[model samples]
Target chain A: MTEEIIIAGFGGQGVLSMGKILAYSGIMQDQEVAWMPSYGPEMRGGTANVTVILSDMRISSPILQEFDTAIILNQQSMDKFEKMLKPGGVLIYDPNGITRPPQRTDISIYQVEAVEEATRLKNAKTFNMIVLGAFLKVKPIVKLENVTKGLEKSLPQRHHHLIPMNKDALTRGMELVKQIR
Target chain B: MADYKLMKGNEAIAEAAIRCGCDAYFGYPITPQSEVLETLMARKPWDETGMIVLQAESEVAAINMVYGGAGCGKKVMTSSSSPGISLKQEGISYIAGAELPCLIVNVVRGGPGLGTIQPAQSDYFQSVKGGGHGDYRLIVLAPASVQEMYDFVNLGFELAFKYRNPALILSDGVIGQMMEKVQLGSYKPRLTNEEIVARYGSWATTGKTHDRPRNIITSLDLDPYRQEQFNLKLQKKYREIEEKEVRFEKIACDDAEYLLVAYGSASRICQKAVDLAREKGIKVGLLRPITLFPYPTKAIREMLGQVKGILAVEMSAGQMVEDVRLAVDGKVKVEHFGRMGGVIATPNEVVAALEEKIIKG
Candidate 1:
């Protein structure tokens, strides 16, 4: 099976890293993966996005227009990427600053209170991990053990101490995510 | 030992250069390819391998630095994007004329004069057809994936020294910025001055030695007949490369009615398009040229006999298609489909073009 996903949000939202970590997990599971970021000057502080294609077979063309899943973070991402989600696909978003939620009957819609959960944990840095946790609950494309290994591999050795906190955020996110339609 | 690591394409190029026993790297920062220099700067290879890493003020200065280093019989390289590469052409011509061995990497972006910073193959003509003023050709290696980006650095240097010419790794913004798993090789020690002198003593400008006559490295030949002879020598060397160094990948060409010819990032898209076309019961295949200069002309010619038509896909208006046309020699119908100014043609769109241009045509 293949999961063609787009994770989009503001630059500092860890959108690219989230895709990287997910891609790393795919590698840990011995799956083929491609992670392509939208780079250039506009990617500095403005809207940022990354396309992660995880597949059992070889991946072709990391540049994608439509996606199997659209994991949106901000209102801008939700509005922009909602149209690109395939019919009967998954649309997961953080309902924090979303003024207009996704209104599509064709695809499954789910909301994860990642921002609120990160605030409760008093760790805004774990916001992306929380959202990632929610994504795993919905899709489970990669096993959690692989994700654990991926996190350990991706983070610096000095930052290993923070793994437990990130894990805690991940668990909280899985619990807080609710299916909409 | 091969160690697997996940890295971006540009970073892979830098790491591979260090491991390939590179003597020096001179480059100016450009979008999509800046990481090549950034990684070299961060590693400070001078401390380890004695590789000199200098951020030259402009692409011109950087290429000249490569010329100087190559003239000394050292493995030197410079990298830039499309526009920056345009600035290095004069220096490139000098390096070629001097018959200096060096590596020049162009992580191409969309172009026709300061075009978008997006990936494009519009520089195909400039890279393979001699961007600089001369009757010279660069050994152009087109890498499609991040792993190739790692492998081709060492390969480019090896080919450069083998021919004593400036070789080019013609990549684009997509491969430069994309991240993937790459198995990096062990580090090789840079050749010592004695070893270089022993191998290149006949032509290298390694300063006067008491045992041998002073070596002179100059492209300037005032005598017209001698200059023509020099040009002919370069032509013979290029002909030899074309005969022995053609590299390409053939995907599902057996019993196919149409062929899609692409290189680099465009080839990746064409691969997916081939899969889509096969699913639609259209016998379409992909022919990806790894060496744009050598061009795999013979393979393309043979495939042209089997296929009814060819679709030359690119990220340019229509650059590589000219080469395909030249290879096919009008034996079969050939058409071009591409998106310029940084816009990439998706796999489905490539399939659509294949159906419209080749399959249905």
Candidate 2:
């Protein structure tokens, strides 16, 4: 199976790191993966996006014009990537700081209150992990055990103690997601 | 045993240099390739394996440092982006003229001047044809994936030393910034001083002894006749390299009626374009040149029998397309399509260009 995914949000919102974690998780499951980030001056404070592809076969074209999934965290991303999704693709987004929601009728849409939930949980950095958990809950493409292994590999050894907290946030995100039809 | 890890292309280049027992790296930080220097500094190979990694004052300084270290028979290297590479062109020419063995990496960005930090293949002519002022050629290796970015470090060094010529890894911003799974090689020990003297003692300036003549390293020849001889010798070496070291890859060519010629990141995109065209029952194939200087002329010429048309795809206006046209020699319909200033052409766009430029032409 192959999944072409685009994760987009503000630069400080862990968009790139979330893609990195997914790429690492794909490696844990012996899948071929490619992570291409939107870089350069635009990444200083502007909207940043990363294209992450996980496939059982060799991946071609890390740069793509279409995607099977679009994980949008901001309205700018939602406005841009909504039309780029496949007809029956999946779009998961957090309903925070978004003025306009996705308008596509063909694709499946889901929402996770990750930012508000992270604030309530008193850990602001686990927002991306929660979103990741919600995506997995909907697709179940990669195993939860592999994701844990991915976190262990991506996060530094000094931050190993924070895994349990992130895991909690992920679980909470999985519960907080609602299918918006 | 192969050790697997996830890493960016620039990070892979740094790690591979250390693993391959590179003696020194003298480079200044530049995007989107600064990670090569950052990762090397963080790893501190000087402490682990006695390798030296230094941030030079400028690109010129870094390339000259490579020249000096190579004169001593050390496996030295340096890396930079397009503009910085332009700054080192004079030194690169000198290195090529002196017949020094070294690896130079240019993770190219968009440019004529201080261009965008996004990826572009505009430096194709500058790399393979000669950006510097000389009739010299660098053994150019174009890597399409992060795995190739890791593997080509050792391969580049091997080729450089074999011919005593400067070798270049012509990467772009896309490969430099992208991350993927790569199987890394095992650690190799640096060559001991005795071993260096034993291997490169004939020409390397390791020190003159009572038993032998002093080895002098210089590209300068005041006499015009001697300079002409030297130029002829360099040309002969290049011809030998072309015959022995031309490397390329072919995909879906067995039943293809059309061909797409590309290299590096552009080639990776063309692989997907080939798939898309095949799905539409368009018999298209891809010819990705791994060694750009050798030009893969023979391979493209061979496609003239089966392929009816050839489309050259790059990130520039049209540089490699000239080489493709020359290879085909008007036997097949040839066309060019690209997006400049760091814009990457997508797979669907490439397919459309093929149909518009080659099929309908």
Candidate 3:
């Protein structure tokens, strides 16, 4: 199985980290994975994106033009990535900042009020995790247990205490996801 | 070997250098390659392994420091990107001229000038060819995966010491920045000064021992005849490296009609293109040169009759392809496809180029 995914948003929105955690989870499950970020100028608080490819076999190119899934967290990302999604592909986005929603009819579009939910949960850091949760809920390519282990692997030992909050955010995202036709 | 850990390629190189007994790292930070120094500083190899990690004032100073440390028979290394590497060329030539065994890592970015901080294989010419003005050769290792990024640090040092020549880990921005599961190697202790003398005493500058003449390290030869002799000696050593050190990875080539020749980051994209072309019933293979200087010339020559056409894919505007063409020598169709200035070519694009330029043509 293979999942080519793009997660794009503002720099501080944990876009790169979300991709990293997913890639880490893929490794935890014994899958070959690559997490390639848009480096250099784009990372200076502007649009930041990472292409994460998970496969049972060896991953070839970490860079790709099209992806099976586009996890967008901002309007700019939505605008840039909405057309690059494969037909009948999965598009998951946070509705808080996105103005022009995904208008593709052939592809499956899902909405997660991840920012609002994270605010309600009193943890802004969980915002990406919530979106990640929505992604896992739809894709389920990786098990939730592996995601927790992924967090343990990605996050430093001192920050391990926050894994539970991130888990909760992920779960809330799973519950609040709405598919838009 | 240690268990698998998800790590960036730059971090893998730093970790590998520490584990592989890299005695000193003198480097100046450059974009897309600063993580090497960042990781080393965080690990504080000095406190743990007694490895000297210094942030030099500039790339020129850093490479010169490498030359100085290497002259003492220490396993020293310095890392940089495209522009930074250009500054180090003079010192690299000096090290090569002196036959000082050292490792230089070029996590290459776009070039010509401070072009861009993104990944590009444009430095292939500067790396595999003599970027420094000399007739010297560096055994260049092109690591496509993060594991190789880790593996090559140890391998580069081994080869450098083995050949009494400089070794280069020719990496790019993609491999420098991407994260992958890397199986770390176990730690190897640094060689002591006594051990250095005992092992490399014939040519190393460990100190003047009564047993033999003083080991002097210098690249200067004012006498033109003596310089010519030295140059001829270096050429002989380069020929030896070419004979024994050529390394490459061939995928799906046994039954292929067309071949894709690439190295380092460009090879990764070609691998995917090979698969995609196979799906479309195209017999496309991938040949990845791991050792760029000691190039797999004989191997590509062996594929002369088996492969009908070759497309040398690169992240630059055709640098390594020149070497491939020279290897094939007009035996079969040879062409180049490249994406430069940090623009990465996708698998489909490569396949399309192969079909358009090689197969359809």
Candidate 4:
């Protein structure tokens, strides 16, 4: 099985890291994975995106024009990637700061109030984790055990204490997500 | 635990250099490839492996430092993007003239100037056709994946010292920035000074000894006839390399009616294009040149009768297409498809170009 995914949002919204964590999780499951990011000065304050592909076999291309899933965290990303999803694809997004929500009837859409949940938890950094949790709730591609292992691998040793908190955020995200279409 | 780790292509190059026992690295920071220098600094290979890593003030100084290290018969290297690489042309020429063994990595970005920080294969002409002055050719290896990025470091150094000529890893921003699983090789110990004397003492400037005259590392002969003789020797070496070192990969070409020629990042994308076209029942194949300097001319020649047309795909304004045309030699139709200034061509775009430019035309 192959899953081509794009995660996009503002630079500071942890868009790239979420994709990186997903990629590491794929690796934990012995899957072939590739992570390609929109890098450089574009990450300063502008919109940033990353493509993560997980496959059972060799991945053909890290760069792609469309995606099987688009995890969007901001309006800019929602407006840009909503139409790029394949028919019957999944789109998970946070409604915070979004002026226009996704308007595609062909793709399945889900909303996670990750910004509100992170604020309630008093951990702004866990916002992306919540969004990732929401994605897992809609489509359980990777196991939570693998994701925990992935988190341990990607996070530095000094920040190991945050794993439990991130796990909590993910759990809350799964609870908070609701299907819109 | 498995030996595999997820690493960016640039980071793989740095980690591989350390693992391969590279003696030293001298480089300046440049966009899309600055990670090479950053990774080396962070790893502190000097402490771990006694490998020296220095951030030179400028690209020119860095390349000259590479020249000096190579003259000492050390496995040395330097890396930069397009603009910084352009600054090193003169020193590269000097090293090529001196016939020193060293590795240079050009993680190319789009540019005739400081164009963009995005990835592009525009440097194909600059790499294979000799970016530096003179009639010198670098053994250019184009790595399409992160694994190849790691593997080519050892291979590049091997070929450089084997031929006593400079080698280059011609990469682009995509390969440098993208992350993938890579199984690293075993660690190798750095060569000692005594070992260098034993292996390269014939030509390396080790020092004057009673057993031999002082070895001079100079590209300048000053005498016209002597220079001509040296040039002929260089040409002969290049011809030998062309015969022995040409490397490429053929994908799904057994019954292909059309072929796509690409290398580095473009090749990875073309692989997908080949798959997409095949799904539609089009017999398309891909020829990925692993070694760009040798150009895989013979391989293209071999496919002349089988494939009806050839499409040269690059992330430039069609540089390698010239080489493809040369290989085809008017026997069949060959066209070019590309997106300049760092815009990558999609698989659908490539398929469309094949149909429009080759099948229809």
Candidate 5:
């Protein structure tokens, strides 16, 4: 099975990083993956998005018309990508940022108070980790263990200490998903 | 001969260049090609292998630096995208005129102006027909995947040094940005500066000793006949390159009736199209040009004996198709299908075009 996802938000919101983590996790899981960013002039102030495709076989194209899942970090991301969800696709949004729910009836929507939860955890930047946790809960493409390994491999040498804190945030986010469900 | 590791195309190129014992790298950063610079920076070639890595102020400066390094008989290289490559044409022409050995890489992006930073094969004519003025040729290698990106880097440098001419790795954004499994080749250490000095010291611009005369490296000749003779020598070198270095891939062309010709990223897409066409019981084949220059005219000319029609597929409006038509020379019905300005043609679209334009037509 192939899972195509688009993670989008403003630049520096870690949207691209989130997609990269997912793609790297897929790689660690011994799956074929592709991570493509929306490059060129559109990346200035407009919504920046990255497409990540994880498959059991070789990925032919990086571009996707309909994604199986979308992680929207901000309201603009939700407004931009909500319509492109395939039927029964999952929409994970940061509830603290998005006030309106998706209008689609066929897809499942999970709104997490990502920023608020991260703020409570005393690490506002970990909101991306929270969204990633929600993504794992919905799709479960790779094990949380694989994601931890991916993080260890992807993080820089100096920032390796943050792995535990990020893992804590991920576990908390997963627990929150369970509580909401 | 070894196991493969997953790498981006740009990283693969950088690694391959290092392993090939490239003496120096001078480049400016540009999108779709920036990872090349980043990879070289992280490797710290000077600390590890004593290779020179310089980030130039502009593409022009970078290529001129390549000219200087190459003139010293070192295995030097530079890289950039379409716009940056356009700026480097002047220096490239000088390198060609001076008969220097250097590798130039153009990781292509869409454009006429500062166009979108998306994969494009639009630089077909610019690369193959000599981007700069005068009668000169660049041995252009088009890479389709990350693996080819690595393989071609070594091959491009080898061809440049062997032919005493500039060679180019003509890749596009798709190959540059994509990640795939690539086998790193065995390291072949390049010649040292002193070794090069001892070998080509007669013509190289090294300081003169008491017994030796000063060397002058210039393309200028005051006498018209001397300049004509130099041009003839360059032409002979190009002819030798064309005869020896034409590389291409033919997929199921043995008995195929319709031939689809493409290169770079577009060729990979056409591979899928050929597969789909065969599944539909259509006899279609793919001709992928790995080396854009030398034009692979020999292969295209040979294919003319069997193929009924040819479809030239590309990301540009119709640049490479012109070359294909020239090679075919009315032997087979030749047509063109393309998408420009950062748009990629899908496999389905290519199949549809082949069905309507060549197969059923």
Candidate 6:
């Protein structure tokens, strides 16, 4: 099975890093993964995004016009990418930041207050991890354990201590998703 | 050896350079190519592999650093986009004149001036026709994917050292910024400095000694015959390169008629057109040149004897089409379809041009 996702938001929203973490997790799980960032001058502050494809087979093209899922952290991103989702696709958005829901009726939508949830964990930047945790709960493309292993392998030795905190955040997000569902 | 890992094109180039045992890397930051510097910096090649990585003040300084490292018989490289590469022509010409072995990468963007930082193949003529002054040619390798980006970095160094000439990795912003599954290859280290000095030190400018005559690396020759001899040597080397280094991909060109000739980013778009034409039974194929300098003239000329017409597709305003026409020598019709000034030609536009030029004809 192949899954393509686009993580989009403002420049400082950690959108690119979130995609990179997903790609690293896929690689650790023995799946083919590609992470392509929006390059050139367009990535300064105006809608920075990354396209990630995780597949059991080989990936042909890294440029994807349609996505299986879209994780939007802001309303602008939600508005820009809402129409490009595939039929029966999944969309994960931040309810606190985006007030308006997507107009499409063919896809499943999950609205999580990621910023609020992460702030409850005392780290607002862990909002990306909350989204990742929610993504793992719904999709099950990669095992949650594999993602933790990936985090350990991908990060430097000095930052290894953050793994437990990220794991805890991920578990809390999974629980939050279950509660919301 | 064939294991694959997902990597960006710029990161793949850096990894490939390290695998090729690149001795030194000096470059400035530019869009579409900053990842090349970032990857090198993150990897800390200096501490790991004893490779030197330096961030120069500008493109001019970086290329001159290449000149310095290459003068000392060390494997060196520097990368930039179009405008930055334009600033490096002086140093490139100097490197060419000195007959130094160095690799230069041009992650091309739209240009004539400080154009937008988007993918464009408009640097075709500037790269292949000698962007700098004087009679010179660099071995140019055009990579279409991340895998080729990894492979060509090693091949570039090999070609540069084998011929004592400079080499270029000509890539566009699409290939640079895009990510693909790249199989990381085993690191093949080059010869040590001591070994290179012992082998080619007779001519390399290390130092003047009492037992040996002084070595000069200047290109200035006052006598006309000396300059002519230099030109002849360059021509001979180029001929050898053309005979051995011309690389092109022929897709479904063995049977039936119409052909599409493209390279770089345009080649990927033309592949879609070819596939669509096949579905309609138009029998269209693609001929993509991987080496722009060698031009793949023989392959194009061979196809001219079989195909009805060939459409030259590019991001520039028909720069490479001139070479195609010259190669075909008016044997078969060679038409051009291109978009200039940072515009990309869509598959529909290319197919429409093909229909008007060949299918309907």
Query: TM-scores of the models, in the given order?
Result: 0.98, 0.99, 0.98, 0.99, 0.86, 0.87
Higher-lDDT candidate among 1 and 5? 1
Q: What lDDT, from 0 to 1, does candidate 5 have?
A: 0.84
How should the candidates be ordered by DockQ, best one leading?
Answer: 2, 4, 3, 1, 6, 5
How would you encode candidate 5's per-residue C-alpha lDDT over A86-181 as one tens digit per residue?
A: 898888887666777578888888877778898887877898898888788777998988888778766878998999888887777776763222
lDDT per residue as tens, model 4, B1-361: 5756888999999999999999999999998999999999999999999999999999999999999999988999999999999999999999999999999999999888999999999998888899888999999999999999999999999999989999999999999999998998989999987788876657887667798887889989899999999999999999999999999999999999999999989999999999999998999999999999888999999999899999999999989999999999999999999999989899889989988999889
Residue-wise C-alpha lDDT for candidate 1, range B144-194, written one tens digit per residue: 999999999999998999899999999999999998888889999999878
- Model 2 chain B is weakest, by summed lDDT over 10 consecutive residues, at B193-202
Measured with DockQ on alpha carbons, how good is candidate 5?
A: 0.23
- Candidate 5 TM-score versus the reference: 0.86
TM-score of 2: 0.99
Interface RMSD of 2: 1.6
What 10-residue stretch in candidate 4 chain B is worst by lDDT? Answer: B199-208
The parts of candidate 1 lying over 4 Å away from their true place are: B1-3, B199-201
Worst 10 residues of 1 chain B by lDDT: B1-10
DockQ of the candidate models in sequence = 0.65, 0.78, 0.69, 0.77, 0.23, 0.34
Model 5 docking grade: incorrect
lDDT of 5 at B85: 97
Models, CA RMSD each? 1.4, 1.0, 1.2, 1.0, 3.6, 3.4
lDDT of model 1 at position B353? 88
Ten contiguous residues minimizing lDDT sum, candidate 3 chain B: B197-206
Interface RMSD for each candidate model?
2.2, 1.6, 2.1, 1.2, 3.7, 3.5
Provide the DockQ value for model 3.
Answer: 0.69
lDDT of 6 at B40: 96
Clashing pairs in 4: none
Q: Indicate the DockQ of the complex predicted as candidate 6.
A: 0.34
